[model samples]
Target: MSDAAELGAFLKARRAALDPADLGLPPGISHRRVKGLRREELAQLAGISVDYYTRLEQGRAKNVSDAILDALARALRLDPGEESYLHNLAAPKRREKPAPRRVRPELQQLLDAIQAPAFVFGRYLDVLAWNALGGAVAFAFAELEERNIAKLSFLGDRGKELYPEWDAVSREVVANLRTEGGKHPGDPEFARLVDELSRGSAEFRALWAEHAVREKAQGWKVLRNPVVGELRLRYETLRLPDDPDQGLVVYHAEPGSESERALGLLASWIAADERPVNTRSPHPHAG
Candidate 1:
């Protein structure tokens, strides 16, 4: 979709999600055609003219001011991520073509040094690099034919089996993808990933249509690992400052918990498997 169309859709979806009663508006006796606040009602709430708001929603208004955007955001009660997404859709910055993603040597070293499960992800949540435990604890990073997380979460059955909170995590993944799509509207790879997932998965199609925006940060997840059984881990995502398109995700369990013991067992298994590694030339494997 074009930026204008996306902006309009986002505005329409958010507007429809609100209730008049929540915004201190009385429910009229007349039958309402729309589900949420009317255009005029939202305009009044945002301190803007009805005509101006209409034009904005219809993608006719160009060069919207920050003040008006902030007003609209407040009127819609958007969270920080959603508000930022709105601003991007409304007035996106011109972007140059993105380069092919590569894991930095330093990042690879950091992943190797970390005792916990750690992996680096690039655009579209591609597994750029992962340590031994990362591959063992979660899905095998080396085995995935399609390394993109969205494709794995929606299209791959293993993802559903792996994540105990699969439904919630899948929705969050879609939201984060939506945020990335808005930021890089011109990226063909990102666009292709969305198109492929939407075509392959009905659930993905339904969720993507909602246009939710989110940032993947700290979160707790329960995974049914084949080796460790049920492992509950807290994950933290750290974005590579120099490379905004990449993030390092590390998973840890609380001290002396069952999950912690499970992690320790996983580490031991990985260590035992790697003990007989040859010092000769390493075989190249696609991630």
Candidate 2:
């Protein structure tokens, strides 16, 4: 969608979600035609002309002032994230497709060195690189066809099983994807991902229509690992400043907890499997 269309759709969706009683407006006797606040009522509350508000909703308004956007956000009862998303939709910046992601050798080494599960994610949440533990403990990096977190969360069932708090995590993933979508408006790959997911998953379609935005960051997750049973893990995401679109996410279990013990067992098992075999004969005289 064009920026104007996106802006208009977002305005309409937010307006439709509000209730007159919730906003302390009297429930009138007349049957209302619109679902929520009428355009004129919203304009009156926002201290703007009805015609101006109409034009804004109809994608005809240009050079929208911050004052108006702020007022509308207030009138619509938007949260900080929602307000920021609204602003982005109103004034979008075009972004070129990012170059193909390549994990530096040093960064790959860093992932290998970490005792905990760690992986690198590119702009679209593609699993660019991961250590053995990351692949074993979390979702299988090599198993995924697209290696995209959003796809796994919505289009597949792996995320539902992996994350105990699946609903919240799925929403966050969608919101993060939405934020990325706003940042790169006409990106073909991004648009294709959205289209594919929207068609493949009803949940994705519903959430995508809401126009939520969020930045992916550190969070705790309860994972149901087939080998380890249930484990509570804290994850931290560190963005590469040199390449802002790339981030390294590491998952750690709390020290001395059952989860930590499970991780230790996993580490031991992996180490044993990777141990080199002694090939040379000991001595000619040895029995």
| Candidate 2 TM-score, C-alpha based | 0.82
Leading candidate by lDDT? 1
- The TM-score that candidate 1 achieves is 0.91
What is the per-residue lDDT of model 1 for residues 1-287, given as tens digits with 9 covering 90 to 100? Answer: 76777788898889988988888897562377878888898999999999999988887888889999999999999999899888888875587666436676777778888999888777677777888788778877666555677877898697799888988988888998998777676677777888999899999999998888888888999999998799999999998899887889999999999999999988888777846422111113232
- Cα lDDT of model 2 by residue, 52-171, tens digit: 999888888887989999999999998886787778777746667564567777887898878788888776777788887887787766554467888878877888988889888888
RMSD (CA, Å), candidate 2 to true, equals 8.5
In terms of TM-score, which candidate is strongest? 1
Give the least accurate 10-residue stretch of model 2, judged by summed lDDT. Answer: 278-287
Off by over 4 Å in 1: 29-31, 274-287
lDDT of 2 at 281: 17
What would you estimate as the lDDT of candidate 1? 0.82
Off by over 4 Å in 2: 19-36, 95-99, 275-287
In angstroms, the error of model 2 at 239 is: 2.8
Candidate 2, 145: how far from true, in Å? 3.9
